[model samples]
Target: MNKDQVKGRIEEAKGKMKEVAGKVSGDKKLEREGKIQNISGKVQAGIGDLKEDIKDAI
Candidate 1:
């Protein structure tokens, strides 16, 4: 996978961890932050996927 894909996956994992931790600790702020991070990661990964697809097509 490309750098963006790899990094996005890592970031998504970290966000998941943060989200769970926040839930366990009753921290709304942390949970929200994690949610945002997770979405960002997904978007990044999608971009990477598109890039790969285009490269292959060419």
Candidate 2:
């Protein structure tokens, strides 16, 4: 719902695409980068979720 959440989800999707592309193209570097990006996105999304929870609890 927030900017972070939206951006993170978008990033996650992009990373997934990159991962798939990397696998198909046989690029280990690209695949690793994608995995990192995906993890980063998940973290960002988690942060957003935490913020939302805190706000709701207030």
Candidate 3:
């Protein structure tokens, strides 16, 4: 995959870890931050996918 895809996947994994850690520590803010990061990662990955698709189409 491209840089964006790789980065996004990494962020997603990190976010998941943070989310779990937050839950264990009972930190609402951390949990919310993790959730937001995870969603942002997903969006980045989607953008990467779209780029790949367009490249292939052309």
Model 3 regions more than 4 Å off: none
Which candidate tops lDDT?
A: 1
Give one digit per residue, the lDDT tens place, for model 3 in 28-53.
99998899889899989889998899
What is candidate 1's CA lDDT for residue 41? Answer: 90
Between candidates 1 and 3, the one scoring higher on lDDT is 1
Put down candidate 2 lDDT per residue, 1-58, tens digits, no spaces: 7888988888898888888889999999999889888988998898889889998999
Q: How accurate is candidate 1 locally (lDDT)?
A: 0.90
Ranking by TM-score: 1, 2, 3
CA lDDT, candidate 1, residue 35: 89
The window of 10 residues in a row where model 1 has the poorest summed lDDT is 9-18
In order of appearance, the predictions have TM-scores of 0.95, 0.94, 0.94
The clash count for each model shown is 0, 0, 0
Clashing pairs in 3: none
